[model samples]
Target: MEERKDINRLKVVLAEKKRTNKWLAETLGKDQATVSKWCTNTSQPSLEMLMRIAEALEVDMKDLLWPLKQQ
Candidate 1:
């Protein structure tokens, strides 16, 4: 079975919101380096964390996720 890797749209959302990585890091009480990883798609936040991020950014969770391609 092939593993599917979903793209993370964190950086785009942050850009649209005019939010900096530092701001998100501080808001989430996480390290700036950690948030940087998320922005670069080098790592991902958990679903719960994503929820908090969406709330903090005033956006829907779906807005932080890349659209899946139609198979």
Candidate 2:
């Protein structure tokens, strides 16, 4: 089993919501490039940003960071 931190909940949440980078950016009042980075895991959001993200996505903050078993 290969476990890597690259597996993030952001991508899954975005996909489940059918949200695009542009949509997330507009909702978060951020740049699309920044949202793109977040989705691609190139950068991580700050705690404050994560709170906003959880709210915007209608998910609990814990859900946004819930780790999975290594696979």
Best-fitting candidate, scored by TM-score: 1
Predictions in order: lDDT: 0.89, 0.84
Which regions in candidate 2 have their CA more than 4 angstroms from the true location?
A: 1-4, 67-71
In model 1, the runs with Cα more than 4 Å from the true position are 1-6, 67-71
lDDT of 1 at 68: 42
lDDT of 2 by residue, 3-56 (tens): 557635888888888987789899988999998888778888999999999999
Task: Show the lowest summed lDDT stretch of 10 residues, model 2.
Answer: 3-12
What are the candidates' C-alpha RMSDs? 3.6, 3.5
lDDT of 2: 0.84
lDDT of 1: 0.89
